[model samples]
Target: MAEPTLEPSTEPTLEPSTAPAPEPMPPRPAVAEPTPSTAPEPTPPSTQRKAARRERLQVPHEPVTVHEATAAASVALAGIRERCTSAPKVIAVELDIEDGRGQVARLNFKPAAGFKAASWEKCVRGELESVKYPARAAPSHVVLRLQR
Candidate 1:
C-alpha cells in the first residue's frame, strides 16, 4: 500500500484588484416650483336662536300689589279652613283613593311594646286623624295595603 503526503502552507494571501472607479455629478441650478401650501375655506356661522321675544307684558305684576296678594292669601286661607272642618272620625282614618290610586302620606305613629296588632290598630286610627279631608270627599275608593 502507498501513503499520501501534502506540502506545508504559505502565509495567508489577501490582495486588491486593479479596476477603474466611478465619479460624482455636479449640482444643477434649482427651479422655483411654487410651494404646495393650501389655504382652507372659512366655515359659515350658524343662525342665532334668540328666544321668541316673550309676549310683551301689558299688565305690570311688579311687587305683587298688596290688595292682590291679600286677596290670594284670603282665598288660600278659606280653602285650608274648609279642609280642616270636614276631617273624619279617628275610628279608622285613611288615605282616600281615587280610581285605584292612593297618594303617599307619612305616618307619625310608631310601634308599641310587645303587641304588633295593637300597634297596627293605633296606626290605622292615627292615619284617620292625619287626613286633611273626610273620606266622604271621594268615596269611590279606599286604601288597600299590600304586604309583599
Candidate 2:
C-alpha cells in the first residue's frame, strides 16, 4: 500500500462584505406655529331644506267671523223654515269661502233629514248665494247648521 503525501495550503482567505451605510436626510425648514383664537368663528345659518314652505301670504285679507256669516244667511234660512211643512231638521251647509269675496266658491248640503224637493234645497242655496263675509287671510270652510 502506497502512503498519501500531505500538501500545505498557502492561498489568502477573503472576508464577506457588509451593506453600504445610508446617507443622512437634509433638515426641514422651520414652520410658524398657529395661534388659537379665544372665540371660534361664527357659522352662518344653513337653509338646506329642499322643499321649504312658501313665504307669500295666501288669502291677502282678514278673516271672516261666524256672526257675519249667520247674519248674511239668516233671512234666506228663515224662508226655508216658513215653507217647510214639519219642524225644521238640522241641516249643515258647507261653504267654501274665498278671500275678500262675499260669494261662496262652493256649497255642500248635508241634511239630517232629507228634503222632499230637490228644488227646495236649491232654492235655499240660491237665497243664501248672495251672502257675503268679511275678507279672509286664507280660503275657508264654513259650515252652518240651522234648525227650528
Candidate whose lDDT is highest: 2
Candidate 2, poorest ten consecutive residues by summed lDDT: 44-53
Deviating ranges (above 4 Å) for candidate 1: 1-51, 54-61, 85-148
The Cα error of candidate 1 at residue 118, in Å, is: 22
Give Cα distance to truth, residue 139, candidate 2, Å. 2.2
Candidates' lDDT values, in order? 0.34, 0.57
**Residues 1-148, model 1: lDDT tens digits:** 7776755446554654344665668788897665556545545433222222244334332323323322322332333334434322321212333322333232222222332444444443343333343222233323222211
Which pairs clash inside model 2?
62-136
**lDDT tens readout by residue for model 2, 20-113:** 7678888988875655765566554354332233554455454556666666667666776776434337655666667534443333444524
TM-score per candidate: 0.20, 0.40
